[model samples]
Target: MKTYDAIVIGAGPGGYPCAIRLAQLKQKTLCIEKESPGGVCLNWGCIPSKALIGAAHLYHKAKDADSMGIRVGSVEVDPEKLQDWKEGIVKRLTGGVRGLLKGNGADLMMGSARITGPRQVEVTQADGTVETIEATKGIVIATGSNTIELPSFKFDGKQIIGAKEAVSLREIPKRLLVIGGGIIGLELGMVYQSFGSELTVVEALPDLLTGIDPECTKIVERRLLKRGATIHKNAKASGYERLADGSISVKIDQDGKQITANVDVVLVAIGMRPNSRELGLEQVGVKVDQRGFVPADKFCRTNVPSIYAVGDVSGVPMLAHKATKEGEIAAEVIAGHKAEKDWVAIPSAVFTDPEIATVGLSEAEAKEKGIEILVGKFPFSALGKAMAMNETEGFVKIIADKTTKQVLGVHMVGPEVSAMISEAALALEMAAFLEDVSLTVHPHPTLGEAFMEAAAHAMGSAIHILNR
Candidate 1:
């Protein structure tokens, strides 16, 4: 048996960072991972998808460059080459994570770790060998979630697949059926759609992207429609049939009607369930809820104070950055430092064409909370930068308090808004007032100026566009 100050299970965005921080704080730490160090985000979820999205965008732009005076004959996707490039990015990032772990003096062990007691865990190696490990101070659980597979459509790892397989697909399907309209489904669907797949989105909810601002959702829906994608809301994928011609005939139910659509592949991105089962959580007295989420306090501590949980296994808003933040918090708390999960807002960015990024509250959310608010918007169509890039599909919207002039929220959907959302998150995090942003001079001919103008518009004193 080997003992350490801290033992982190699952070297994902959450676990690895926790181990590194523990080591940095001068505590002996060990991180165990069954797969890649950077977890789903680096391996198959966020990073790989973004690499493909970037390539597709570049290809699409080149193919449509006639209006920009750069005429290209034709554009095509080399799936094998693209996958190689994406894998290269993932490899570099995961390698960096490994370097960070080693540089920080954290031990990296490749195995499956399970809590055998409050301070003890058993690691099972690939060679069917089990090793006992003990943590004197804390044990951090960072195992992430897994894709929800429907009973009717089991993943064949080919024709029927989940988001994991969908991202690595080489052969571009002529027709693709995506069974969810949320972030995962829309993102991967758009990637294939750009690669020339006829897309049909079936969403069980009445609307797509349920929690986001409806106006922003509408803009994305318009873009999807323009891309020749079919959307069916309030619909359910009952089952599918494999035709003799090797195509899939998917049967969907929408409002008491049976609709059948034939496609080459089906991507099920409905949602993810927490990977809280097994690993002896219940045996160690950790409270996992009915839905499988191991609840944690603001400090990321589970019911058992000695055992902490982070990432998707911890709670909702299952973002990699969120998990990373919580991971750091848990590490610090375990190391006898003053750290807690404190933040005004955790921003969310959807990597769709033109993109949608948001932080803090929305207008509808504020109004529903019974707070009077002011809404200000500036369109990318009027921005010099947007016009120069030939991508003017969305706008910047700011929601502020009608009384105090405090900026309540910022929402944007346009080119590179994903990179600009951090500023909004900072503004909200610091509780900046509308004038604090409006009065601050933003660099000219940049997408960031929209934020300043949107703030000014909320104050009814915008410069580029009329104040509303």
Candidate 2:
């Protein structure tokens, strides 16, 4: 048995960072991964999808170049070349992650790891050989999550596909049916739409991006509609019939009426579930919830003192950044350092045409909690930079506590707002008052000013817009 101070199972964003931090603290660390070092985000989901989105964005821009006084005849997209480029990016990133693990003095073992016992791990190699690893101190579980598959529509890895398969699709479908209208659906929908596919989004929720601000989603819905994507909200998919030609007829019920639509491909982006199965958690003292999520305390410590869980296995807001932060905190706590996982903001970004970013509580969430709040908004249409760039599509909204005037949430939907959302997240994390954000001078002729302006509007001191 190989002994170590700390053993991290699943070298995902969460596990890797935890292992690295543990190594930095002068502890012997070992990280075991069934797949690649960088996890799903690096290998398939996040990075590859974003790369495709970038290519689609460039294609759309080139197609619209004629309107910008540049005469561009016909634009073309080569999915083969795009796939090659995306693969290159993925290889480089995963390679970098592998280097970091080695440099940090963490043992990178390629295999599936399970909690055989408290402070004990069993790694099953690809060759069907099992090796036992014992950690003297603790173990961190960051196995992450997998795409949810519905009963009626099982992913065959071909016709019925998930985000992973859709990323590298060679031929664009003439008609595509996206099963969910969440972040992944809309993002992939945009990509296919850019590739000249007639895309239709069918969501069971009343609105797209069910948890986000309704007003913000409205703008995206409008843009998607304008771009030729049909949305059917409050719709439930009944079943699908596969034709001899490989096309599918999808039966959907929207408020009692059964509507059938035919499409060349169906992409399921409903949601993801925790990958806590087969990790031998039950064999140990660690308790897993009904949905297969390992519950952990604030510092990511599981019921078992020597075992901890992070990322998707720990549940909600299954984002890479969240996992990374949790990994750091878990390591710090293990190293005898003062660390707390409590934070006011963990930002969520949607990579649609007009990207959506939200941090902290929305107006509805505040109202549901019976907290008195005030909201302010700044339209991108009024921003000089937005107009100049011809990318005016959405707005910035700020929600604050009515009593303390503390900024509660910042939601934005516009071009590249994903990059600008970190500012809002940082402010909310620091418990910054509205006045602090408003007083911070944001440079003129930029999208960032919209955030500051929104904060100013909350205080009724915005100079850009007249008093409403």
Candidate 3:
């Protein structure tokens, strides 16, 4: 049996970072992966999707540049060329991951791994050769998650599909019907919508992007509606049928009424389920929750001290950055350093049109907790930068404590709000008061000035906008 100090499974955003950090800590670390390095986030979920989104955004902007005084004869989209460019990016990033692991002194193993004992792992290589390895220190499980496929609408990888197929479509569908209205569904749906596909969204909840600020969601929803897309809220897609002409007829149940939508493709982006099964975790006495997530404490330790779990397999939020942070913390803990999952807040960004990003508590959440709060808002419509870009559609909102004037949350939905959110995250992490941000000088004619303005509005001293 081969022995090592630590073994990390699944070379994803979580696992690769943990392995690299452990090796840097001078531990004999081995990272095992059954698929290509960088996992789904780089290959399918995050990177590729963003590539498509960026391309679609550029195309959309070009088509509507007449108002900007830019006149072009014609515009066209070459799906094959776009896909080739996206694949090139994926190839470079995944290759870099491989090089980084080797450079960081982490052993890379290509195989499917299963824990056979408290410290023993059995790896089955591609050639059917099995090797048993022992981790003298610990084993970190970061298998991540997989897209949930509905039984009623199995993936054909053509007509009906999940996010993986959605991002790789060579030819844009003429009409697209999205089954869910969550982050994945809306983001991808809007991408295709920008490509001139007739888009229809079916959401089971009362509103789109549930759990997010409703005002922010409304702007995105309004944009879709203005673009000739159909949105059905409080609805469910029961099943789908394949027509003779190679089209999909989706059956939906909305408010006790049955309706049918015929389209070229149907995307079911309901959610992702943790990849926690068939890894021999049950046999080794590691507890997996009912939802298939591995529960870990502050130190990322499982109930069994020799085992640890991180990333999508560990819990909610299921974000890549969150997983990376947890991976580093776990590595530090295993390396004899004191580290825990201690953070004030995790910021979330939705890449929908006029992107929505939020950090810390929302106004509704604060009120639900019986906490008195003060709210401030500044619209992009009033900002010079947004007017210059001709993409003014959303606003920035700040929520703070009424008594202490401490900043509780910052939410934004506007142009490049995704990039502007890091400042809000830092403010929350440092427990900054509303005045802390309001008093700070921000450069003129920038989208970020909205944050400072919103903070001032919350404190009843806004310059650009009137206080409520």
Q: Candidate 2: what lDDT?
A: 0.91
TM-score of 1: 0.99
Ranking by lDDT: 3, 1, 2
- Writing each residue's lDDT as its tens digit, candidate 1 over 290-355 gives 989999999899999899999999988999999999999999998999999889889999999879
**Could you tell me how far off, in angstroms, the CA of residue 291 lies in candidate 3 after the best superposition?**
0.6
- Per-residue accuracy of model 3 over 149-259 as CA lDDT, tens digit each: 999999989989999999999999999999999999999999999998999999999999999999999999999999899999999999988899988889999999999
**Per-residue error at 425 for model 2, in Å?**
1.1
Across 1-468, the per-residue lDDT of candidate 2 in tens digits comes to: 889999999888999999999999999999999999899999888999999998999899889888788878888888888899999999999999999999999999998887889988999999999999999888999999999999999999877999989998988889999999999999998999998999999999889988888998999899889988888999988899988887899999999899998999999999998999889889897999998899999989999998999998898889999999999999988888999788877999999988999999999999999999988899998899998888988999999999999988999999899999999999988999899999999988789999989988988999887645
Q: What is the TM-score of each candidate against the true structure?
A: 0.99, 0.98, 0.99
Worst 10 residues of 1 by lDDT: 459-468
Which candidate do you rate higher for TM-score, 2 or 3?
A: 3
lDDT of 2 at 329: 92
Please list the C-alpha lDDT of all candidates, in the order they appear: 0.92, 0.91, 0.94
Q: Which stretches of candidate 2 lie over 4 Å from their true place?
A: none
TM-score for predicted model 2 compared with the true structure? 0.98
Span of ten consecutive residues with least summed lDDT in model 2:
459-468
Which regions of candidate 1 fall more than 4 Å away from where they truly are? Answer: none
